[model samples]
Target: MNPDNAATMVAIEIQQPGGPDALIPAERPVPSPGKGEVLVEVAAAGVNRPDVLQRRGFYPPPPGASDLPGLEVAGEVVAAGEGATHLIGERVCALVAGGGYAQYAVAPAGTCLPVPESLSMAEAAALPETVFTVWHNLFERGAAVEGEWALIHGGTSGIGTTAIALCRLFGVKAAVTCGSDDKCAAALAQGAAAAINYRTQDFVAEVQRLTGGRGVEVVLDMVGGDYLPRNVQCLAEDGRHVSIATQRGVTAELNIMDVMRRRLHLTGSTLRPRSTAFKTALAEEIRREVWPFVESGQLRPVMDRTFPLREAAAAHARMEAGDHVGKIVLTV
Candidate 1:
């Protein structure tokens, strides 16, 4: 539980960007907390899609960010830099720009949320990236409100499940698209109002049918490429389309006339590469608005599995295999 004088730690680094095997174990000097940061003795770190992309050499860490591939971690704060001393002894889950695939990592004090007694280290580790993304894209940028319906792709993913849970909590209905019937059922069980097996059904038509031809108020899309035009078809007039990731492909051709006529809004964001001040503000807003549900045990990240930190390659392989139904974590 102590990090004092721990000069080195084990980290999973990308030996080369290619495949799961690219992630390799290495010895690294334990990082120090910079001003307004805390050194966390990591208990668990969340494995995310971005980590996979990073491993494949498609995504790289932002400048000044750690090259190691991980975005979130849950741990005990063992040391703190000048302005962050107050967090030195707290249990926290933080969203980091990088360097989470290690036994210890430095995190911005502002991005760290207090881990409540109700949450396990693994579950806490799973929250930051997905929760922040969903909250920002679905509610803030998309402007989804109570009683509205949202269409989310990747129903079984960390982002999808977190979006469903948050939608349920906030009185917004979520209809999700999954690759399989089983994943669809899982999404329904996780509180999605409807789940479409995209592999078997036409999601655009199904969405139209589900909403009785009115269409949903928002579309939370991660699958880009061809899905973007179809997603636009699934939206109601003035509906918002928020793109968080481009899993399918990056390019898409949308009907500008349709967009203009329907008054649909298309917007997307990448959470990394954003300024520290912006993330800090976002963290504060999430703490004030969303932490209550977490503190009350009403919100928790859906966990699929946990792997040992050294088995990070296997973890990435599991994610790429696409059968996991929820968040995956690397236990430290």
Candidate 2:
């Protein structure tokens, strides 16, 4: 918050809407956190799907957020604004709208959570975006319950892996679908009760067989083309279907009769553009309901690899390649 200490920091900027090479490293002024904010000396930042979209000039930062290409980071709080002074010296992992691919970034105080003592800075960096998202959509939106079956698509993604771990830790029965047998195996290893290889198996049929034709109580999906109607058929009576992303295509023509016949509840959300108060409430819910599982060692971050902060373009390329298993991180 001090003008004198607002030094310049190296960051990756999107010079234009293009490919990974468009991510150009440059120096930018260190951001000063406003009221109820904290200045993080970033140790590491997570590379997410949204970042990839942002790099391609598709997803822009939310209103009033930085145009930088990062959504989450882990580091120590070097300074705090007005009412956030208590967090000035604490180490934390924070969920942010942007500006994380750097040595220094600003985050809202309420979006920050203490980095677990057992986690390294890199692992901590991988938690915020995926964790907040999984907790929000799966547990909160899906209303996944103990002993109940939940199906997650893209079972090896950051969201999928985190969801699997949280489901296991919370006693939810998980059945996930991945692109390959290897990723399917990885999903099962992460505690999914069953892993379906979408490349080889019919996930709807598999889900039916896995749940004795009752179907899963909740279906978490990001793939939203024909998967939409098929996902509806994969749900149980009165089931909840929550879609967080549409990796295939956005618009889907659904049979209203099918939705009504199954009594399916359809929903979806995007985190970055949300209000700070909304994110603050989600953070509080995570602290109250999810922190214990993290502390008890039931949840651990699964990281694929770490690239230096300046090599953010490479990280984005790797993510686009879709070969990595878990989260890709950028270490400063």
Find the candidate with the highest lDDT and give its number: 1
Off by over 4 Å in 1: none
Q: Quote the positional error of residue 169 for candidate 1 in Å.
A: 0.2
Predicted candidate 2 versus true structure: per-residue lDDT over 86-179, tens digit per residue: 9987989999999999889999999999987888899989998999999899888999989999999988888888988889888999899898
Scored by CA lDDT, what does every candidate get? 0.94, 0.91
TM-score, structure 2 vs. true: 0.97
Which predicted model would earn the best TM-score? 1
Superposed by TM-score, candidate 2 places the C-alpha of residue 132 at a distance from the truth, in angstroms, of: 0.9
Candidate 1 per-residue lDDT over residues 39-154, each given as its tens digit: 99999999999999999999999999999999999999999998999998899999999999999999999999999988999999999999999999999999999999999999
Q: Candidate 1: lDDT over CA atoms? A: 0.94
141, model 2: CA deviation in Å? 1.2
Residue 121 local lDDT, model 1 = 96
